[model samples]
Target chain A: MIQSFKMALKSIAGNKLRSFLTMLGIIIGVMALVILVSLVSGATGSVTDSIFSLGSNLLTVTISDDKGAPINLQTLNEWMEKDGIGLIAPSGETSATARYEGNSGSVTVYGTTPPYETINGLSLLLGRFIKSSDVDNHTNVAVINETAATELIGYTDCIGEEVSLDGVKFTVVGLLEDDEKSLTAVFGRGSVVAYIPYTSLMRLSSEATSNITSFSVSAETDMATAEAAVTSLLMERFDQDDDAFTVSSRDMLEDAMSDVTSVLMILLGSIAGISLIVGGIGIMNIMLVTVTERTREIGIRKAIGAGRGVILQQFLLESVVLCMFGCAIGVFLSWAVLRIISVVVSSLSISFSLEWNVVLIAVGFCFLIGIVFGLYPANKAAKMEPVEALRYGG
Target chain B: MIDLKNVSRVYQVGSGKVYALNKATLHIDAGEFVSIVGPSGSGKSTLMNIIGCLDIADSGTYLLDGIPIEDYTETELAKIRNRKIGFVFQSFNLIDKLTAEENVELPLIYRGVGKAERKARVAEVLERVGLTKWSHHLPTELSGGQQQRVAIARAIVTKPSLILGDEPTGNLDSKTTGEIMEIFRELHEQGNTIMLITHDQEIAEQASRIIHIRDGVLSEVSI
Candidate 1:
């Protein structure tokens, strides 16, 4: 084996350019694998982050009938207690034009109770969010988001300022921070948000007054179990009407997106893997030529009593050496290229991530390709009759 | 010792059977030197190949040092060849990439000799060919005479029972041929069994015995 290894090295060294050309396929194959797998991982990572951020441990309950019962706080508390859930935030939204100091523009007002901040992850940039007192008292105080405060009032710190929705005047109690970036991070693409008390909004004479569309719930443990419990509770409550309420969680959506990303990566990676086949074919092609060129050498060795196994090993080892050399070069080249690409795409938040597992798999794949493709030609050389091979000529 | 009884080798040439060897038979005891001479296509090489175990006869028994040739596997034949026979081609056939000593060590390597022993034997054979100083040079760096000396060194490094030379000086001029033949004659004088095949009558005449092959038939010639 050692002797065969030495001969293989010598043979490759003897034909430097041909050996390099044979390695090109492996280089391309591994490079493609690293870059494509990294991109897919990055994309899936971003998607999972957004979905997980939305509500990794939370479940959403919604009923289209809006019987004013499924979304009520009493009903939410009942389900929360039954399921050992910790928080519930009832949420509703409306697009309305607002005016302040002669500045007028549209604002999306999310009406919810006091638990919205903790449950829905709405943090305040200034002042305070809507409290339970404000909801119970039906106070006309509002929590305008960063966009609404700036666009409508021309003031980032607009607490205690008066703003009119249509014809109703209300005091801005809090300025909600902009969640536009986080939203884009979740959905891969965002706008702005505003908040007000659900009770105060119901006083605006909406036809669905006191009716609820959706409420978000959170449990302290075991999301799968919590989600199932919540879904079944909602289903049983809506026994009067089937398919009226829908309960959903982020994990299911995450799994779906994960599957999508996996299939996508495999498809793209397979396309890239084709280059490995092409590379293997190149190695085989060059190896066959090398066998023919070294026919007389094979003859001499055989005549000197080198066995068929030795000749096969020598040729097989040559191809393996070439492929593995190519793999090393490919890995280094792609790592360098990915470094440069990451630097260039830094502003775009797109990373070409090369993981160790991907590299190991690529290297292993390259070796298998070498053995598979190298076998036939090596066998051809090994099986040659000594006299016939020695007599072979131009 | 070498023995052949009715050994026949046939070649298919353009859909016709050409008798490269036709019931040819010969024998040589240990420590004897003989030469086989013939014109082109007269089966002289076919005979040498069979004797050297590089080729097998189609329909006869060949006993080399008491081992039946045709009945053994290629692997077994290779082992027998490695231990009992050495080959010297007219073209030298030294792998040019290897140094002189490395070429001489080839058969010993196949024989699984230890590195220390291989080094000693290779150095001894290079000295025997009067090429101790040229052991480190590649085949291309050596002159034709020196290269043939390396080939002869390679042939004798294993100290095999039989040394077969095929037109051992065919590629050399008269002076180089004389130098290479001098090495073979020395080995023959040292009690080594040697069989040299040459078409030149002058080359064949130096052997103690000469065998002629004409139309694939062999006969002894009185020296």
Candidate 2:
């Protein structure tokens, strides 16, 4: 058995070009499998992290038209006072240019109530968060992220300083810090985030109470009750016969993202698997040709005492060796590509992780492919009559 | 000793049956140097295959050392081939990827010899064949005569009772053929049973007795 295996290995190595070509299919298949799974998981990880940071207990309520455009906040506010509700935040987002002295930069202005900061997991790097008094008093105070403060005020003191938004001055009350590098691009222009009183923002944007962009709500203790209360409240507020608003908890959002990623990974993996099948066919074809070329050798080996099992083992081992070689190359290439992608998308929280389990699965698949395809040729080689094989090319 | 009461092999070729061997009967005791000589398609190679346990006769009985051949399964026959028989081919059918020593180690490997013993026996066989110096050289790297010697070394590595040669010197030059025949003569003198198959009368004459076949039927021709 050992002798047969050694001979098979030698025979495969004898034809370097053929062996390499046979491995190419497996290489591509494994590479595709690794890269696709890595990318999908990376994206899913970042998204899930982002959603969790938004506070799992909190739910966002947006008053929107049938086509999903924001509607009146007055009606949304009336609905929030319903039974089983705890807290509701009507938030508005706007893009505007902020200038301090000569330097000017684009900033995303999030106008909301005081509860918005706590609900969204925002931390003040300097000064204080927006207070209830600020909303009531319609204060012209602004809390800006480190990026916005830096861009608008340079290295100068930002707290108590005034930053002009489209020539309208507002006093900087606090500085906010970004959680991850990914937050900058996802939130808006770079890391520029500014928070102002909702009343002031509504006055500045010149919109009526009808323009309620979004609302963030938290359930009152019981989850089942919260779900039922929120759904019914939204239904009643919208005056619709059916459910209209998209109300999802943190768990639901995470699950949806996970499902999407799983499907994407599977699709990509199947595409890679197609290449694996092609690779298996390549192995089969080469092995069959090898069996033909070594017909006389096969006969001699059989005559010298190699049985059907030994012959089968030899051919099968040759194919498996080819696949294993390809698997190594493919894994290496996938990791290299993932590394390059990681470097390129540094700001997106994208990371590629190699799963050894996946690699083991790939190896097993390669072996199976080899054995499945190797059966026919190996059987043919084993069953060859010594006399006929000896006379084959004589 | 080898015995054949009656042996026949019929092959399916297209729509009709082709009889490769027809009701052949032969016998040889241990230590006999014999030859089966016939033109191509004359059943000499087929008879050799049957004798080597590489193929079974279609009908009738064959006994090698008093054991029935037809009743043995392919695997059992493989064990017999590995244990009792060695074969040298006309083309010097050595594995191209293996060194001469490795090729010699093959049969022993199938016999489940330990690595150390297999290596020692392979070395002994290579030395016996006078190719110990080329033990590390692959078959393709060696001359045809050297490769044939390696094949001979491989065949005898396991110390089998019989050595089956199918036109073993067909690919060698006259000098190399003479050299191989000399090795065969030494082996025969050493009490090793040899069955040489050839179409060449010159080669057949070197054997102690010649058995001829024409159109799948045996005929005796004394040399």
Candidate 3:
């Protein structure tokens, strides 16, 4: 058996070009699967990590009127003293054009108090976080993301610089790095973000209203009791139906992200699966031809003393070797693609991990293709009568 | 010794039955050099195939060394062919991808011989066939006569009891023909039972006895 294997290897080596061509289908199939799966997994892992990094126990609560009525600040102030919620950071957000020097880019200005930074896990890279005094005194101080800061001041410290939004001057108190760059919205193609005090923002902006766009909340330690208490508080404050607004916990958001990613992965995997089918068909086609071409050789071997089993082994081995070599090349290509992707999306922490089980499954599928495609040829070769095969040529 | 008792083979050829062999019975003792001479379709090749265990007789008792072979399976027949018989074909069916030595080692490979012993035996057989110098060369690189010698080496390397030649020198020149006959004469002298099939009387004359076949029937003549 070992000797036959050596002979088989020599035969394949003898026809290097033909062997490589035969491996083409396998190469493309494996590469497609590996690259698509790794990319999807990397994206999924990044999104999941970003959500958890925002603090797993975090929740968001917002109250809106059924008829879209303006929020009454007096009622909201009473609700803010609700018994169940431990922390609430109301935020008002709007989009505007910002100009720094001669370069201009569109940016979203988030209006929020100092408590919003701690609730949303925003940290300062330079200087300090937004202060309660700044919000109370209605100071026009801003905390910008690293991207915004870099664009406005280059590498110079922006701690004392002023950035103008719509010709309104705001002193830079701190620079914050955007974590949501990793947890991007569906249609958001990465934009710069700047933050300022909600009171100052409301006073200067024309579209400002008492209607709060959203609020991040940290419920008391007893979430069940807090949920009930907050529900009644909102009902009393809004004086409307119980279902007037929506409240979502971090776990719920994570679950939704997981579902979306799972569907995406399945869709991508099926797309990759088409190539494997093509590859398997290619193997079957080549194997059938090989059997026909080697019919006389099969006869000669059998005439000399080889059994049906030996003939089967030789051809099956050839098929598997072709596919396995292609799979190896595919794995290498996947890793190369990931390296390129990481370079392209450096701001987002996306890692293409190697899953051994997935690789093993791919290998198993390759072997199955070999055997499934090799069956017809092997049977035909095995059933050949030695006398007829010897007599075939003459 | 070999025995055939009422052996016959029939083939279904498109609504017509072709009698390849017709109830032919013959016997030969050990170490006999015999020839079967006939034109195409005369069943000489069919007889050779049956004797070599390449095919089974339709209805007959073929006893090789006192064992009935018609009852044997295909695998059993292959083992018997490898151990008891060798074949030399007119076209010299040496595997083109194999070197001369590797081609010669094929039969021994089936016999489950160790690699060391197989190599040693292959060298001895190649030397005996005057192919030692060309042992590393492929069949395509060798002359017609040399390629036939490689085929002969491959046949005999397993040390089979009987060597069957189907027009072994049909493709050779007259001069190469005489050289091949000399090798046959030497092999027969070494006590190997030999059977050859040919249409040429001059080639058949080299054997000790001749069997003539016409339309699938055989008649014997002393040579």
Q: Give fnat for candidates 1, 2 and onward, in order.
A: 0.57, 0.75, 0.60
Best model number under TM-score: 3
Output per-candidate TM-scores for chain A, rounded to 2 decimals.
Answer: 0.77, 0.90, 0.87
How do the residues B83-160 of candidate 1 rate in per-residue lDDT, one tens digit apiece? 998899988888877899888998898899999999999999888999999899999999989988998888888889
lDDT (Cα, tens digit) per residue for candidate 1, span A1-394: 6777787888788878888888988999888988788777876776676676675667777777744444566666566577557677787777677888778777666778887788767678899988888888889998877767777788797889998886788898888776643635344322445677888777753723565778887776777777767777766667656478877788777778989988998897898789998999999999999889888888888888888887888888998989999999999988898888879767546556677788998899999999999999999999999988888771
Quote the lDDT for B164 in model 2.
Answer: 91
Q: Candidate 1: which pairs clash?
A: A50-A186
Q: How close is candidate 3 to the true structure, as a TM-score?
A: 0.91
In model 1, what is the error at residue A150, expressed in angstroms?
11
- Model 2, A273: alpha-carbon shift in Å? 1.5
Worst 10 residues of 2 chain B by lDDT: B93-102
lDDT of 3 by residue, A108-164 (tens): 888877667777877778888778888778898888888787766675378878778
**Which is superior by TM-score, 1 or 3?**
3
Q: How well is candidate 2 docked (DockQ)?
A: 0.68
Candidate with the greatest lDDT versus the true structure: 1
Q: In candidate 3, residue B76 scores what lDDT?
A: 83
Q: What's the true lDDT of residue A144 in model 1?
A: 78
